[model samples]
Target: MTRFRAAPVLRALVTLAVLGSVAACGTGTDAVVQGGTFDFVTPGGKTEIFYDPPSERGTIGNISGPDLMVDGKTTSLSDFAGQPVVVNLWGQWCGPCRGEADDLETVYENTKDLGVAFLGINVKDPQQDKAQDFVTDNNVSYPSVYDPAMRTLTALGGKFPTSVIPSTLVLDREHRVAAVFLKALLAEDLQPVVERVAREQ
Candidate 1:
């Protein structure tokens, strides 16, 4: 397994973003309501997330997306059809996503020899360049599809839901989802699942 580290530039950018968000809060001079809690409303009411952590299972139809970049080539989900694949949904701005990157990369490295293909789906974010840089910096050697418009996510019935970062779906050789990991993955935590899927092929 490879040990992954975040680039200094990415760390700085994340720190700045956090600071900016914190600085935007109201100051002492601002008018404060008495004894009333602030209520936050989502644009479309409460989002129904498709992923359930307890079940650890989800089935999605054949989902596809446009090529982003991987190993310097453009590719799509359809290319891996007929092969068992581990699809990871992630974003550069997400802390959990960063934590799971190395685990995913390790899975890719270990399972490729066993005929398992790893695919990445990048979610929409304000910083596309930084997202690409994150992939490059980590030396991720798997294909990643761009989801700037979240087309693939929408196709998977994930729109209007506050989808968390670092969700992963495992598809069997026939392209049917076998399992869904709804949280950040660690290399040790994923080994059994990887082995099971790889052996199924």
Candidate 2:
């Protein structure tokens, strides 16, 4: 089996973030990458994991649903409880998001009614109109919560620290996170995990 390598999308996001941090903090490479050690061994040694949040807090996938708005309406992760929810974090300016938009939409089209839900958290995007336009251009019919303020994102970080853009979290039927992909993806990268989670009792 192929271990999931850090794809170009993940590398790009990390590079952009490092550049921004370097500009903002005037720090060297080591300074920007902070925090202490974290040890997590993926199940079966597969890098792109099938995981559950380890505790009630201080880790990824341990939080409950966040309330947000899309197209002037309100919704939350909890609303889709008892169903697998594909939560994708993206932004309009992100090249990888644009590259992966169709893949997300394709999987969404295929599995929407099979007790699966797809939600987009459009964060760090300054213009809501342009973000909506991207969805339209991609023929992505799924509703995405516009999060210019990143309120939902801030909440996510407080609960689960993997707040990288162009990331995806596959929440199992019980609303627990089943898997997380910290990179842009093809439909193939997504469908297997989604199908597996959907099969959960």
Candidate 3:
């Protein structure tokens, strides 16, 4: 009897077909397509945008924000109020994280001068040493909470989505969700978004 080897090939085709269907939506959350809008891949990994630039585009949620521990100090979002804040979730082994590290640092350096707060959530990192080294090597000046179990992430409730490895959440000066980028980010991709929020009253 000839062995049935079509199953694997069929499964591969189906996977590709599903990805194509999502891409065909043309919403541009898929980094490959570039920004038509901000993408917050939620519960089912479906794309959603909670906010946009220049003005609030969607409903604002009641988020008390989370208090994450960094370097033995208790820190909360409230501590960064009165200015735009950027929260980035990343890990050591994530390839995209490495690629975007410099971009994040560059933007942070420039925007910090403008009083923007950048916080990093190091999630699911198996190797804390490697994670710290990554920050040191990349010259990441932002303070990051070590979240091997993602406690800080989960504690945020639905305020922040930690499902995306290199996700970024941009908050306006009012501390409301301004934009959520569910992909690896670049300095150029974030500068305008941050500046827009900073300019808001």
Q: Top lDDT: which candidate number?
A: 3
Task: Estimate every model's Cα lDDT from 0 to 1.
Answer: 0.64, 0.66, 0.67
Question: lDDT order of candidates, best first?
Answer: 3, 2, 1
Q: Can you give the TM-score per candidate against the true fold?
A: 0.65, 0.66, 0.66
Clashes by residue pair, model 1: none
User: What lDDT tens digits, residue by residue, belong to model 2 across residues 1-201?
Assistant: 133465766888999999998787532211011121223333353336556442321222322222233433555555576778898888889999999999999898888878899888777767767887888788877766666556555444433444457878787776666777777899999998898878866
**lDDT of predicted model 3:** 0.67
The stretch of ten residues in a row with the least summed lDDT in candidate 2 is 28-37
Number of clashes recorded per candidate: 0, 0, 0
Model 3 weakest 10-residue run by lDDT:
28-37
Give model 2's clash tally. 0
Model 3 agreement with the true structure over 1-201: per-residue lDDT tens digits: 234688777889999999999878743211111112222335365443446554634322222222233343544555676878887889988999999999998888888877899978777876778888888888888777666666555433344566678888787776667777788988998988887777776
Q: Candidate 2: deviation at residue 6, Å? A: 65
lDDT of 1: 0.64
lDDT of 3 at 158: 40
User: What local lDDT does model 3 show for residue 169?
Assistant: 76
